[model samples]
Target: MSKLEAGIVDGASAGYGAVACTEATKNPVAVANALLEQGPHVMLVGRFADEANKNFGFEVVTNDHFTTPYRKAYWDQTAAALGQRDSGSEMGTVGAIVLDEHGNLAAGASTGGPTGKVDGRIGDTAVLGAGLSADSKLAVLCSGAGDQIFKHLVAANVAKYHVTGSSIRDAARKALQSISATGASCAMAVIDAEGNAAIESTAKLFSVSWAPASGPSTTGLLPTSFPILPTHTIHQCLRNRITVDRALWGGALCSCHGRRRCLSILPLHGLSKEWHPVTSKEKEFHEEYPGYISSNDGPMMAAEKLDGISSRIRAVSGLTAPFNNRFNGPDEDSKLFARIIRGELGQWRIWEDDHHVAFLTPFANTPGFTVLVPRKHLPSDIFAIKGEEFSALMESAHSVGNLLRQALGTSRCGMIFEGFEIDHAHVKLIPIHRHSEATGTTVTVAPFNHHYQGSVTSLNGPLLKGTASLTLDAAELRKKIPVKTITSPRSWADPPRHLSAVLQEPWYKSLFTIQDALFHDSIAFFQKQLGYKYRAAVIQAVAGTTAHLKSLLELHRSSGGKFPRVTVDDALKLVVMNSNDWRYVVESDTSKGRTLTRDGELKLIQHFGGAVWVTEMDHLSVPFYQAFIDDTQAKARCGDLLLGNGEVLGAGERHVEVKDMLAALEQHQVPAQGYPWYTEIREHKPLLTTGWGMGIERFVAWVFQHNDIRNMTIIPRMKGISFAP
Candidate 1:
């Protein structure tokens, strides 16, 4: 998790390019190279340079050439010259996206709000729901006052508009307008795979005006307060955040007790099912199966005779017991035991004791149905069960499960069993649904039940249909109390390292890679589309092309050092200028008036034309922009980069052209490690778009939306020691 100080930046202000196709693609080196290839009129934004490098460890996307201060200075001077003066207290924001050689696009953003600021002052750059948007092929983001952005639900709206056939610009305008109408001061942009773009702002002449030092300020016009924009919405932002969090964190099952609790016992009878066992009277005369012999003293033995008539159940079904264990004595609750065993007075489906064994009648609701030895505490394990016991257990379980569907009208039945808890073995008769009812499970008992601490509570049961006696069916009893998923200390030490086999598959890798790429691309594109233009000049003295270089030098001299000197510097400027492609804008803490933009430099230059076009002619020493461009385009194509425009560009001549242009722009750009991970197999890919946004404080500050990871887990378990309960 990257931890950058918080603040805000507004797109409604002058610095950003505002809107363009693949606008957020900021690969600095690539962007600079691309700019050299294009005419000088093009500008780029080296957005999020400081924060990205410090926090994310590496650039996911966007150029990393310019610092926040540099970008802010450029915007500040531009605003000043245009008659808009700077207020020192506003936050700095930069949003960027970069495309890798394989066409994967990465997006990210950063911001610093009003200097002496209040906490929780979120800006467009920091808040994902409004700040950034990414998916395979394109990326989009915004920069402006968060309050205003939220009014429009900008990020989500932009995405929606893009999907509905609007160009990046169109969607941005629509989103911005929606919020503007709501009185939110905002600016927005969008970019797509095919180079289509859109940008729109609700207000002009917007400038950062500090809020009162001690109290709040009322909403005002742009340059002061970005009252509202089209795309920001509280509900939408929340929903999107929740969805992201859920995806980031998989099932919350805890390994504390080392058991999965797919189905938890809820205190609701309607949510449970009960079963019964077959009886002698229920079986036909010819369907007899050998039974266990119970002597007058209660000693039990298996019958040796294989009567042609078949045991009580053998004729009708090839069922047998799954396990057998002999105990000399029974618990003091023999009356309760007898009732359960005889299937006469107990409500449970299966029960056993020294005196007898009986199973309650089966029901339509029960599946994988079978009566098994429920309470035989012994050292022997399942391995001891063989031949008839195994066959009977399996056959009965299968038959019962099938019959249950016939009885309950469900398609399948779920079977589960665990010999770890009770001294005895028991088979679970569960009815499976089209979808498993068990969201997850946790095992709380462990290490000889050492963690055991008892909780006493009164039980709840149903009144008999016509009688006053309370009848607690096992299923009902299970539901009457909340069953905790226990975690065993031993299971917590170290889960089996993620199975390498499962991770090695293409599907698994694709899930992460494509998602990441899509996210970066989407965000970068959005920011670029939303940024404003600037006059970028390269202060270079190319050997052979001194005349051409002289012209750039002249332009720079005229701009009063506003232009960059080195190719790298030029690249950085372009990105800073175009950073908003996939970034957001929000107000600084000093006041609601400030909004920010952020992203990569190289990607910026590619999206927005820069001063020079990298010719196959430029010196090799000069970083090539076309290569970066090509890579970015490839990333987009492979869904590694977001398509801000929300439309797919299939491969062919047009795509080829875009690819070439990108390659040219990317030439000479520095490549980073792990860049190839974003690549994917072209033939088999899921129809998905992905991007990542995180809560810096949540991860860094150790405070989560749900308080902590522990709160979100089934059962908290740490290393080595086994906890038993």
Candidate 2:
């Protein structure tokens, strides 16, 4: 590519002797080398120089070239300052796709590439046809787990769906379903020929903003924020050269064309087929070709078999007679609704009480399939539930059903209480998006009848979408409270020589600084400006990013002038026992927020720890962003880094108390204010301000692919070992 650039430059300088299309197309590489004279070899200095300028506010770094021969101090110095930003020297980095009005469609992805990706590895972002695609009929860009997105070519398929008559919203949703089905979170932006636009994500991290075509040009608007101009989109600014240069560049159009401006989750098609397992009778009759399973089995036999399977399968998670020895005995069966108070199972619990616990079941026949189980070990018979008990259960069921619809982007919910499954009295609440789905589970726990089908994704089910952390009623899965008596001994020791030498390379050592800057920059984008801000600023988001970064860097230098690295297995050991611990969950502290849900948590992890985009709500308007770490590598790496060695430096409790006390001190401010001074001052007046401290280190690790976040931190601080304080 660099050679091509140099050739273009040399040609411009040489003369205007243009080659015909046939000659250029047949021998492009030959033409660049020339017919005889020694060909000019071109070496590229890589894009880090320009990337540094764009991200770190550096100067003299953008679009600059220098004589390269390992001797040019000026160029060498510039290049030295920039290393592999994130995702190493690999196959695919990151990309931003946006339509430009420079009369051409230029796709630019502003978000950073997945941090610790493999060398020679590329994801959808690197593939134009996969992550981004455009034509005369439509254009689309997608974000999420790139591998899944690439396989489905979400961007291209979205365009196809749009041109084939699907509405803009429908097209985007349908395209995303392919990736979401794989339990991978993804977001997409789409625009059709009519200029109608839509954006959707299976997960909640999607942000769509646009300025009117004739309105403010997207000149300086932050990419993560709103797009000020139709053309100056964040993606356009960071457009991928390969994508642009490889395919012909052409003029681009606006998604929300014309002078209108709008940014919202577009209404989806009001239709979803009620998916269900094959009826027991049908399954038995057709189990094997025409003969089926035990061809002569009586109709009653099918029901009996299905019921037995449900009873066993539903109880498969934590039965007393467990295999791995995790469970002392079998827990309650699915149908036995009364045994729902199994908090130890670590399932996604929404609401629970002494009589009943409402939770999203892993046995989800449909997305967001929830069940209300009674605490008592009662029989599956509804008659077993006394009037008062029934009333109470029904009341909660009604409420949960309603919340599921409201919070999950569905209009109706189907309630079922079939005795065929586990003899337990459990009530199922399935969000009903279409008339057919009203039947709830048509088949009796068939395997194929699963939630998050690798089909088009939708929140039409209680398939809780956004609000990765926000639940219906500040509800969280009630975890088995940790043993208060347990004591952790913090200890520390120097790492192996190889690990200690990890950051010796200058470029490698800079990983910490670069990612820290990225995080701080994100903070600035959220804080209340001298002008507008959010409606509600979270009280705990008081940690200033600048201060935090400075302190963290100081610690990193002190530790080893770099972060440490650890094997995945070794990293997991730090928190394996506490994997179920709430602190590990990617979310704001549960005590602070009202709406808390773990649907996203379970969805992402249940399948090797990948996330299905939060399919439902817009959490920003409610609580702050609730991060859900679904990837295994990202999750385990975080545990190791967070522990430092055997434990974190500050006690979580004291830290919270200090923050709260600080907030209290605000009242003392001369006629002072509370923690979020903006709320008191009405900074972003009228807008509900929401705030939360994003785990910058975790994000950095994720993007930078830091093996041991310790690589970026100070010396290992263990619980038992004292540091050189």
The reply for model 2, stretches above 4 Å from the true place, is 1-106, 214-389, 392-725
Cα-lDDT of candidate 2:
0.38
Clashes of each: 220, 77
Worst 10 residues of 2 by lDDT: 241-250
- Per-candidate local distance difference test: 0.34, 0.38
Which numbered prediction scores highest in lDDT against the true structure? 2
Q: Pick the candidate with the highest TM-score.
A: 2
Candidate 1 lDDT by residue in tens digits, 361-410: 23212212333442333222344566655555556556555654554445
For model 2, residues 1-725, the per-residue Cα lDDT tens digits are: 01111111121122111111111122222232231123332211124222322332323311113124552453345446655333322122223333444323334332223433443344565344676665555566676677777777787777666666667777676565545434455767665545566766554234446665678744221111111211111111112211111000011112223322221121113324542322233312222111001111122323344444334333432323221212122563432232235444444556544456666655444445667776665544565577887888788788777777765556766665543345456676766545333232111211323332222211122322233232221222112222121111111234443343434633234443455445454543332121112211110122111223333443553445454433332323443324442232225643321211233233223322221111212222121112212321111102212321122211111112233233323422322243355333334333322233344544544333333554444344446654343
Clash count for candidate 2 is 77
Query: Whole-model lDDT, candidate 1?
Result: 0.34
CA shift of 611, model 1, Å = 23
